[model samples]
Structures are given as C-alpha cells and as structure tokens.
Target: MNRLRAVVTEIEGEQNLHIITFDCAGSSLKMMGLDLPKGLHLNSHVILGIKPSHVAIAKHLSGELSYSNQLQATIASIENGKLLSNILLHVKESDVQSFITLSSSKRMNLQVGEQVTLLIKASELFVLEVLDA
Candidate 1:
C-alpha cells in the first residue's frame, strides 16, 4: 500500500455515507466511505492508504474525470516485467507506486522524469491511521 500523510479539511454526507476531503502538501484529495472512525473530525491528522494497482496513470490528460483524487506526479523509476510494470512516482515529497500492464507501460512510453497525472477513486482511499484527535 502507498501511504500519504494528510489533514482533514472538510467532511460531507449524511449518516453512514461520507465524503471526506484532505490536504496533502497543498494537494486536495477526497475519500468516500460508509463509516467514519471514532474521534475523526476536521483538522485531524491522518495517514491515507491505497493499493498500487488501484492507481491509474495518464499522460497529457485533458478535460475532466470522475475520479475524486487527481495528483500531479513525475516518474521516478520504472520496472517492467513480462506481465506487469511497476512505476515509482514522486508526488510532492511522497513516493507513490503504481502497477500497470507492461503493454500499457510501453504504449504510454513512460520514462523517468516524465510528467503524468495519477488518478485514484475516492472509494479506493481509506484512512489507514489517525494521528491526532
């Protein structure tokens, strides 16, 4: 899992469903979930987690997307295997890894230091740990 340190900025929704927004090094990220952790509230410091395979990469992307979290990143390194490719990205100060098919990696021609956008669904992100009350 890729973990990022963030602070809760806002929260919306009713009852069991909620859409929580966070700020990670000035980047806005959102996560949707059915349950909220105890003592979680505005300004809470948290560690967010997501799986590598859940991260999507886009080069020269345009227009809007349905994904709730979109982060600007640069390719740090890539390891291509026969069936899958692992891409390491530098997002601000954090290093996030993404796993994509080897074919997709070649099709995008992703290289080290290339600029790309990382897309992640809100439902895929979760609060891995709460650092503060």
Candidate 2:
C-alpha cells in the first residue's frame, strides 16, 4: 500500500455517506465512504492509503475526467517484470508506487523522469490511520 500523510480540510455528506477532502503536500485529495471512524473530523491529521494496483497512470491526458484525485507526478523509477511493472513516482514531497501491466507500461512509453498524471478514484482511498491531534 502507498501511504500519504494528509490533513482533513473538509467533510460533506448526509447520513452514512461522506465526502472527505484532504491537503496532502499542497495537493488536494478526496475520499468517499459510508462509514467513518471516530475522531475523523475537520483539521484532523491522517494517513491515507491506497493499493498500488489501484493507481492509474495517464500521459498527456486531455479533456475532463471523473476521477476525484488526479496527482501530477514524475516517474522516479520503473522495474518491469514479465507480466507486471512497478513504477515509482515522485509527487510533490511524497513518493507513490503504481503497478501496471507490462504491456500498458510499454504502450505508454513511460520512462524515468517523465511526467505523468496519477488517477485515483475517491472510493479507492481510505483513512489508514488517524494521527494524534
């Protein structure tokens, strides 16, 4: 899992559903969920988690997208296997890992130091832990 330290900036929802926003190294990220743990409130410090396989990479992306989290990052390193590829990305001050198919990696022609956009769905992000206030 890729973990990022963030602070809760906003929370909006009704009933059990919620849309939580966070400030991660100056980048805004969002998480959607139905259940929130105790102590998760505005200005709360948190550690966000997401699986590497869930991260999507976009190169020269244009037009609009529905994904709530789109982080601009630079490719730090890439390790390709026969079937899968592990890509390390530098986003702001954080480093995020992305797992994609070898075919996709080649098709995108991703290289070290290249610029790419990381796409993450809101529902895929979760509060891995709530930091002490």
Candidate 3:
C-alpha cells in the first residue's frame, strides 16, 4: 500500500456515509465511504492510503478525466519485471509508487525524470490513519 500524509479540508454527509475532501501534496482528493474512522474534523491531518495497482499513469495527457485525483509527477525510478513494472514517481512532497504492465511501460516510453500524470479514482483512495491537529 502507498501512504500519503494529507490534511482534511472538508467533510459532509450523515453518520453512516460521508464525503470527505483533503489536501494531499497540494492536490485536492476525496474519499467516500461509511467505514471512515472517527474523530475527523476540518484541518485534521490524515494518512491517505491506496494500492499501487490502483494507480494509473498517463503520458502527455490532455483534456478532462473522470478520475477525481490527478497529480503531476516526475519519474524517479523504474524496475521492469517479466510481466509487471514498478514505477517510482516524485510528487510535490511525496514519493508515489505505481505498478503497471511491462508492455504499457514500453508503450509509454517512460524514463527517469520524465513528466507524467498519475490518475486515481476517488473511491480507490481511503484514509488510513487520522491524527490530531
């Protein structure tokens, strides 16, 4: 799992379900679920969690996307395996890791220091741990 420290910006909804928005690496991100931990409030610091497989990569991307979280990142390192490739990206203040297919890696021609976009759906992201202000 990949973890990022984020600060809660807004929270809305009922007791059972809530739509929570947060700031992660200067980008707005949201999470919607009933299983969110307790004691979260505005400006609360939280750890955002997502799996590497859930992350998608785009090269030279343009136009709007359905994904709620889109972050601009630079390739830091890449390890191509037999069937999969592990990609390390440097975001504003965090290192985001992604697991993609080797074929896709080759097709995109991703290299170290290359600029790429990281796309992640809101539903795929969750709050791992909540901290006090």
TM-score of each: 0.98, 0.98, 0.93
Judge candidate 2 against the unseen true structure and give its global Cα lDDT, from 0 to 1: 0.96
> How far is 31's C-alpha from truth in model 3 (Å)?
1.4
Candidate 2 off by > 4 Å:
none
Better of 1 and 3 by lDDT: 1
Off by over 4 Å in 1: none
User: Model 3, 1: alpha-carbon shift in Å?
Assistant: 1.7
TM-score of 1: 0.98
Candidate 2, 4-121: lDDT as tens digits: 9999999999999999999999999999999886789899999999999999999999999999999999999999999999999999989999999999999999999999999999
lDDT ranking of the models: 1, 2, 3
**Model 2, residue 87: displacement in angstroms?**
0.3
Candidate 3 accuracy as lDDT: 0.91
Q: In angstroms, give how far residue 54 of model 3 lies from its true place.
A: 0.7
| lDDT of each candidate versus the true structure | 0.96, 0.96, 0.91
lDDT of 3 by residue, 93-129 (tens): 9999999999999999999999999998888889888
Off by over 4 Å in 3: none
Tell me which of candidates 1 and 3 scores higher on TM-score.
1
